[model samples]
Target: MIFDEFDPKEDKIFRLIDNEGQVLNASLMPDLDDEIIVKAYKEMLFARVADEMAVSYQRQGRMYTYPPNMGQEAIAVAAGLVIRHEDWLVPVFRELGTWLAKGVSLKEIFLYYMGNEAGSNFKNAHHVLPFSIPIASQVQHAVGIGYSIKLKKIDEVAFTFVGDGGTSEGDFSEALNFAGVWQVPVVFTIQNNQYAISVPVRSQTKSINLAIKSYAFGIPGIKVDGNDFFAMFLAYKEALEYARAGNGSVLIEALTYRKGSHTTSDDPTKYRDKGEETEWAKADPIIRLKKYMDHKGIWKEDETALIEQYRTEVDKQFEEAEHFTPYQLEDVFQHTYVDMPDDLRRQKLEYEQFLTWKENRK
Candidate 1:
């Protein structure tokens, strides 16, 4: 019994569980078997550890630029759990957690961040496309994939993750419109993490809720508490079912916050207040979920120790990633196309010769 008493203007913010780990809506609870609960806990733990390790790796110069999803573990893990492995995941850059949940290898992910072409090679087993950095471009790709699935009469759906800023893009609007008109099976998840770089949500749009924007496209829209794993799971589960049943696309605006800087290069202190970060930290998704597990007697001290041990392994993996040979200058030319243009071929040869001369001098 998800809350039906939502105000389009105010109650669009659906919350089944509060930040203190209290269940606000009993109906929103999934049929939590012990096995499922434990699995959720493990996923949450892994996400947190991966996030921390990514930050540390970036600082150690083992990884290229990285974004930290410290507080939004529940949104990614719960959504991932609800979707099938065969489903396509079209993720934006901030959705590393979502990609991980979709069966992307940690080594491959590290390789991508380390500038290796192998990082983007998980195309077959993992239906996840490479992470898109151009904001709303991936939304169109999701819509396209969904359209193709519908044409093939396949029972598959595409999930596209974007931020509040992406909602303002023309691509976002076009994708939603196309999905609605074509009755494509897709889930457009807008993780509204408050600020779009330095722009606040208040200035992003005049609409009261991002979910309501879907109404204009003639699609069902729902807003969920992104930090509550159960709530997000339920919302996504319902939306996915609706799509599979040929009800077309659904828009889910997950109201959440980014608890850290936008990326390793970002400085939140310049644009946002420190108090806001502290506020979100107290309501951290991992902490709240751990509390919930503790109250249910599902979390144990020994299990925590095991998770820490896993973190140590992750650290070791990062060290291994550092030893991978960086891409050679000539390797870039090989992957550019099936047949390199004559000009590019000549340039490649010249660059290789220059590198050889420089190496001989050294």
Candidate 2:
């Protein structure tokens, strides 16, 4: 198995493609059909376009502080390709490509950032949890879902994502411990994008690599080149198989770089060097995939025209989200508990009264 071959404890990273899109390991390359390869490239392109547009919208004050999934698209795109509709996707604030792949509309994503609670209500998307902003809390949620699936004897797997920094959180360790003990069908992915906002991975942990943390929990772990889509695909595919067969959960550390800022509110230039950014840009997932497709003669779409089309579609969705119904006051307090606590009810009433008083003065 790939996991056994490239053990995380050895600090060996599995890679199939190089920066120039050359297949470094032909034997390790997945035997995907030409059409599927084309689809993956298209999805990655759309994700890039959408991500750039989302950042633009936030800069224009059309949206809130949005996280950019610039260089980390391959990890999500690969996971999206592997994940079935019945599988659960427990995600952090990022993973835009995965969300789109799993039937989430751009409008819904925009609405969520626009403070519209309706955005969190992904009516069409199935088995996908709302975006988790708190550090590693969602890791536990993914484990719990996996446990439920195991108890019910379901065939579905639970896939969860966390940043490299999140690996230090107690919730992450606790969740992995439970998942290992229970042998739940969970695939834990750590998007080791070099930083957690301002802190680098070196500061996050002293382990040889993030994937090695899984060893403590008695689960299989693999470190992969996140920029190489084929490597990620193979990792997820194998991880899925291992978990699905009732062996146990697997942890995959996707080594990648976050080219964009931590969020629209923060400036990457303050903490990231231009030279480093340029170096990482060379390994961009979209560019690499396009180059691979170019070599294979499968990338037949007109680039300029396709980008224009994507821009128009993204803009239209942003406009729809911008003009979405204004957020209601009750939305903030209603979902926290099945029955609203008296303190929360009183706070909601106070906010309503304050709004009324402020409006009356106008």
User: lDDT of all the models against the reference?
Assistant: 0.83, 0.93
Segments of candidate 2 deviating more than 4 angstroms = none
Clashing residue pairs in candidate 2, if any? none
- Per-residue error for 137 in candidate 1, Å, reads 0.6
Tell me the tens digit of each residue's lDDT in model 1 across 98-217: 777787767777888888887787744468898788989999999999989999999899999999999999999999999999999999999999999889999999998898888799
Error of 1 at 245 (Å): 0.2
Residue 163 of model 1, lDDT score: 93
Worst lDDT 10-window in candidate 2: 322-331
Tens-digit per-residue lDDT, 46-148, candidate 2: 9989999999888898888999998998999999999999999999988998999888999999998988889888988999999999999999999999999
Q: Please identify model 1 stretches exceeding 4 Å from their true place.
A: 1-11, 325-328
TM-scores of all predicted structures: 0.94, 0.97
Between which residue pairs do clashes occur in model 1?
A: none
